[model samples]
Target: MTNEDFTTFPIDAVSQERLAAQGLRLGLVDTSDAAAFDAWLRADLRGFHQGDPSEKVLKEQREGLAYRRTTGVWDETVDEPVVPVATVNSWPANLTVPGGRTVPAWAISSVTVAPTHRRRGVARAMLESELRTAAALGLPLAMLTVSESSIYGRYGFAPAALAADLVIDTKRARWTGPVPGGNVHFIPNERFVDEVAGVHERYRLSSPGELPVWPLRWQQLAGLTGDDEARKRGLRTLRYADEQGETRGVAIFKIDGGDADFTKHTLHLEHLLAETDDAYAALWRFVLEMDLVSEVRAGLRSVDEPLLWQIADFRGVKAEVQEHQYLRVLDVPVTLESRSYFSDGAITLGVTDDLGFATGVWRVEVANGAATVTETTDAPELTLTVNQLSSVLLGGVRPSTLLRASGSPVPDGMDALFASDRTPWLSVWY
Candidate 1:
């Protein structure tokens, strides 16, 4: 990758020209300079608050709980100083993908380049720089919802998942017959963290496409990340456990209001994990029953989520479809073994690498819940590239689909091997 000329310090016109002539300079935006970048974001994006109390209030009261508990893509990487010229700063909202299970990936926020620094490749540099940084960080993948899809493909990022948003009226959400079961209670957000984990883990282990939430991610969700507004909003984690004391599901949300004397009760569900349809119905019923919350907003839900269908009055909900996270295979063997595959026995296959995840052939042995992957140059039955491998890895994009695509290699028995149980469906994005 060619280094860009842009640096932390302001560049002169002549220096800018020289840098532009050579190529753009790309670099990380140091954390020490976060304030500067924040300022740039506020100015560039009109209507954005200048870190005011109102924004804090909004965060504290409405958005803070979700940001604190919910894990989305915005992080230190997005702040990288080197800007690319092609950024749309579009801030596309929630997106959905239907692969057996519905997936919710929301990209509701973003910040781009300064006007003076525009046209010089700030956004492009920033975008590519973040991809490289994410790769180096060992993150399995990176994703963003975009109005301009053309911009991200150049950096080896692809649309791996999608989601849709829905607005429903409570009066329309007819509560069906309730299954007498787990008791629901209002608990402190921090106290309910474990319950949330328990429920989410149940789903995560069974779900093909969900990523494991790290400790720091939970901390962030609980408003424990030193974001003051989140604390003030009284953000609490809500959980429902069975009589045996096992947590079935949890929802993170708070009460909200606007200036127009509207009492808006929004539930920004950070994570809703339930194994059964009954558990899901009960949990959502609990939320809708909250006394004052008029409107409920839940983020990161799968498209065609059963909750909507479960509600008798489906029209009460309004939804918008959006893009969420994107995935790329960095290390083929490691990637294959990271998640559980359904193969019962061992098989020798010749794997191909078009995106350069790995080269030559590999022998992968799967037994029980374990797998052994080794490099092998010997002739084999199947051959496929990194992209194709990634598609098959999730089970959403079939091996047959990859073979059908132009330039993809054909392999015998590959379809049967991949079609074992069900195609993988990642319910969440990193």
Candidate 2:
């Protein structure tokens, strides 16, 4: 969809009206004008405390800006400097749901407001506008990877997926899993875009909370372009192919900090994609057995990765869990009915939403592992805010836990109906 189609913002109308009284205007960036768009980027970088971009970095950023719809909060009272005080951008994409279905989603990112603009309602104004636009586009959900944990809860967003930070002492761990019969080869970094995209497409389909990786991201990850050359130095790319010569897995990583002792080299995994369990095992085994690698570390991995189980001594691996993806429900009935349930039952829920998008009574009925949600006037069996509902929607948090924490009334079998056999996981950052 075009950027213009995603620019409507009815939820922030009240905030805009209030800001106008103070001589500020919240509006879309003039992407058609190159100079105006660059000014917006500079303002955004300043808010994040990043240095001025080099020419190469600016060119790459301009390519990505084409895919996003950007908005800014401008101080119209100033005539000389027209740069905005705050910036936000979003793009439309499909996100995988619990039942192996893809639902319309708004991917929000690049959120920032100048230090001078804080406490003036700039952040709230931009977020409300994005949420309202997503609802108007008939999207069921909006998702983001937050820079801070405490900022988005008041906007009816909650942690919906969890990830793990893994560190493995390669010297202590011994591989015990069946040896995968795949041929692994080193490939040039320039060919990564075409080679890895196919494997990642198959992998992300069955993975919940995954969004399609855009082309610009693939280029950046492969070190074909962008800033951070210091981190990209000595990067290596590996591709795994089966006996039939079909590529099924790929990995990008780098070794650092040997410090004149080859045994002290540390391997950092940047990204790994596998289409099959055998391919997954092969990739991990290859990395674990590499010469002179003292340790391996990766962040934002699935909590249930099989590498921990494949080692002879599980204690060699250490994992720390953290929240990854936060979700906000945009349409109550559709979002509830889209995912499958575990048990056959019925329950009424009264969801309170400050934005009024999902604020209503819903009767969710399930039978034979399918759910049907409809509007109902019956008294709700449970009552909670939209943020609480989002936490439990993916089965990441138990309904009983939320009920006890909030002191809300819970019906008899609500836990059995909402829990999932698999823990919800999301590995992608944005």
lDDT of 1 by residue, 87-190 (tens): 22211111211222322221312435444455655555455444333334443334454446666555444544446565556666766646638866667766
- The TM-score that candidate 2 achieves is 0.93
Residue 178 C-alpha lDDT in model 2 = 68
Model 1 Cα shift for residue 132 (angstroms): 5.9
RMSD (CA, Å), candidate 1 to true, equals: 9.2
Residue-level lDDT tens digits of model 2 in 279-311: 888888899998989899887888878888899
The CA lDDT at 4 in model 2 is: 48
Per-model lDDT: 0.50, 0.81
Q: Which stretch of 10 consecutive residues in model 2 shows the poorest summed lDDT?
A: 1-10
Q: Candidate 2: RMSD over Cα atoms?
A: 2.3
- C-alpha RMSD for every candidate: 9.2, 2.3
Best by TM-score: 2
Native-to-model Cα distance after best TM-score fit, residue 318 in candidate 1, in Å: 6.9
TM-score for each prediction? 0.58, 0.93
